[model samples]
Target: EGSEGFSDLPCERYHLPRPMGRLGKFILPNLLLPRALSDRIGAELLHVVTPYGCAFPTLPVPQVVTIHDLSPLTFPQGSSWMQRAHFHRLLPLILRRSRAIVTHTTRVAEALSRRFPGIGGRVHVIPPGIPSLPIPAGAVPAGRPFALHVGTTEPRKGLEILLDAFREFPLDLYLVGEILDRAELEREIERRGLGGRVRLLGFLPDAQLARLYRAATFLVVASRCEGFGFPPLEAMRAGLPVVASPASAALREVLGPAVLWAPGSDAAALQEGMRRMLQSRETREHFIAAGKAWADRYGWERFCDRIERLYHAVVSGPPRGQGSSAPMRLSQRPDAPQKETPRKREIGTA
Candidate 1:
């Protein structure tokens, strides 16, 4: 499964010019400008893999990009006007120019195809692999039994609903992520008298997160939408059952039957779901087994194989036509290699 761009060792650093935050990112030393400069220095194909979708560079070389989500457009309330305007100006152009486009989940691929019909055949679903971190012996967060919530305190995360749900139960609510909507969260914390019970442990490293996951009763995701839900999958890898909102198509698709789905992104639904999980040990264990088995199906090795193939195809193929072309749908590689190799197909993207 090895390839030129696929390195298992620690990544070598590239000290590209850092762009200033916000609107300044579109000017000199912009997000893509450093990438263009890097392209000139290196023979690597530009792969805009991050959630920041507007970073596709203007270069002579072949390019591939991963559009994780369209949250800025679909859920505009969570994004700023500058972000909305930036996406509007650059997203379509980036999609059109990219040699291959990847989405984190099939849900995202379908959504993107609908939103940008021109990008139909180019889109491919490539769910991110769960990091296989060794669980080291460490102190779990010393507290009462808590329901863990991981992610930034954004409106889309539905922290309000989570806090509201916490009022119904005695279980402590432990939130670990950057506090973006601090004032809004604090107000609810105060109003609900959850000062001590609700712990906002901001930005824990992976080691610390592992500890927190071990200590938690279950993972709770109240997000209104997601490109690909990582927390539930991560929790499953740790043999932890999940209580998640089903509003996100990506989350629903990724988690499948692994998570104990909350009926909606509301306080009542979340409370009911958590109550069920807390009340029944059998249910939790069943989900835990299912989750672990489900998580095993995805790994970095498989993702790398697919990505490596895409890079090779893009470099070898001619410039794409405007019309739709068949995607390079990769099948699951066998545990052992066969004597006769399968024929590689002509996959084009525009």
Candidate 2:
């Protein structure tokens, strides 16, 4: 799923001309001249696992890049000035030079294509598989049922709407992950008088998180947008049901009927979704079965195998300029043998 891979395969190494500065990383095509390096090392291909929004300068070998999300571009205020500048100045150039682009969801693929036309054919959608979670060590349940929320405390994540909807409920609300918008979140909690009910358990280890996932009633993701809905999918993997607030197309297409979908992101709709999960045992059971089965399809073995095939296609397909113009769909599974993967598999990109 990332570029810091192919370590297990045999490879040669070379010394760069100079160490790159922070900004120099995004503009490496100018400073580092990777094309000259690749030529010297006999490299056949180059992969940027997390290029963010930078560097697709003309290169000797075909380049493949991974883009996590476009949240920074979509919500400019949420990101720093440096990020905005990089995306605006470099991303388009990077996209044009690359042989192919890899993304986690079709929603992102659609957004990328819509934002910058003529690149849809080069974008490949692949929902990455999760790594192994920490061993469960019970700490969150504390003898009370709670709704779990993971990731950052950004406004677009729909935390405000989730609190307004669930604050009146009898259960507790535990938010895990970093607190990016603390002032805003604190203000919301104060206004609602949810001092005791809402707990901001910031940055807990995965062991603690795994415990909460297993014991929670259900996972609620009221996000306005997501590249890949990890919490909901992981909750499903834990045999826990999920309720997504108008689950984005990326999630809907991947999750299918495995999650209970709220028609909107309003308090009323999310409240009703929670009500269904708490009151109806059948609803819980249905999503649990469907969710687990859906989650199983994203095992690391499958992701690695599929991505490897994509690499083989790129390496063997055509010259740097001319390759297949057809779009690739991930819904169909390949009948290839599974390879044991750790972190990322080593491939002969060079």
Candidate 3:
């Protein structure tokens, strides 16, 4: 049912094959195939779905590639050569034969349309849904305040810029996610004398993360590019306001007018945004309410319904026009001049 690569491979291998097999079916060619060889042999059977926009080897089957963002194409400096090469080689064909191109946000849909004209009608926006977590009334902490950042360690994540801006604020900065660049980040923290104030709490379990979100004041995201930007949405579900970068269109699309946007790479601008977020109670309350409403709009049942419809459309025929029953409930927030959680104090080094 699935092949090995990196991210989705294990999930496919361990879970996918068993159910299909139990239902009196077996994936052809029992041996695991190398990615390259698989691309060649399974070309006819391939239906490539990925965030990166790239063409794969000539395939006979309908390729339903998912474009998360045009980051590699739009911001080449932050991408690896392998990623760049893969996208460059596969994007054209992927776009050409894609039965239904899926994207996480509307901004990406617009970008895809602008960059590769005539395909706007084919693109479908399927925002990621957060698993429902039980919310206890009055679970939110009264006055314990902290700014949260969640993501892997990477330059494009804008962690360095966030640190620079964070120094100006008095609030504690708690980073929750795996640290991919331990030495580099530690060095930066040391250089900036942020040892005590800025804490990097590596990946946390869902329950713990929820508790942290409940306790936190607000969530902060400073990514240069994001396909979906799950953390802010997750934060919003927990009833927290978000302060994020304007560089990520996905963040802007999902958070809408609820977020406080700060310019990427501008420490001064980030500092100003942070100061305003910390000081304005009215702004905080407004965002909290608006964010909750926005978060509720992205129901998983609705998202799945759209996906199922798109799948049927892709298999049976071409997609309907863009304006045809807008798949998502567009945020009603009036577009203002751009841009733009919570959780524990646990640290881990990797």
In model 3, the runs with Cα more than 4 Å from the true position are 1-61, 134-144, 263-265, 318-350
Global CA lDDT computed for model 3? 0.66
Q: After superposing candidate 1 on the true structure, give the runs of residues whose Cα lies further than 4 Å from its correct spot.
A: 1-12, 27-40, 51-57, 138-142, 322-350
Native-to-model Cα distance after best TM-score fit, residue 277 in candidate 1, in Å: 0.6
True-vs-predicted CA distance for residue 257, candidate 3, Å: 1.1
Candidate 2 local Cα displacement, residue 80, angstroms:
2.9
Best by lDDT: 1
Off by over 4 Å in 2: 1-42, 53-58, 135-141, 320-350
Worst 10 residues of 3 by lDDT: 341-350
- Looking at model 2, how many pairs of residues clash? 2
lDDT per residue for candidate 3 within 204-272, as digits (tens), equals 977778877888878988887777777888888788888887877677777788788875547778888
Candidate 3: C-alpha RMSD to true structure equals: 11.8
Q: Model 2: how far is 125 from its true place, Å? A: 1.6
Instruction: Compute each candidate's TM-score over C-alphas.
Output: 0.85, 0.81, 0.72
Give Cα distance to truth, residue 284, candidate 2, Å.
1.6
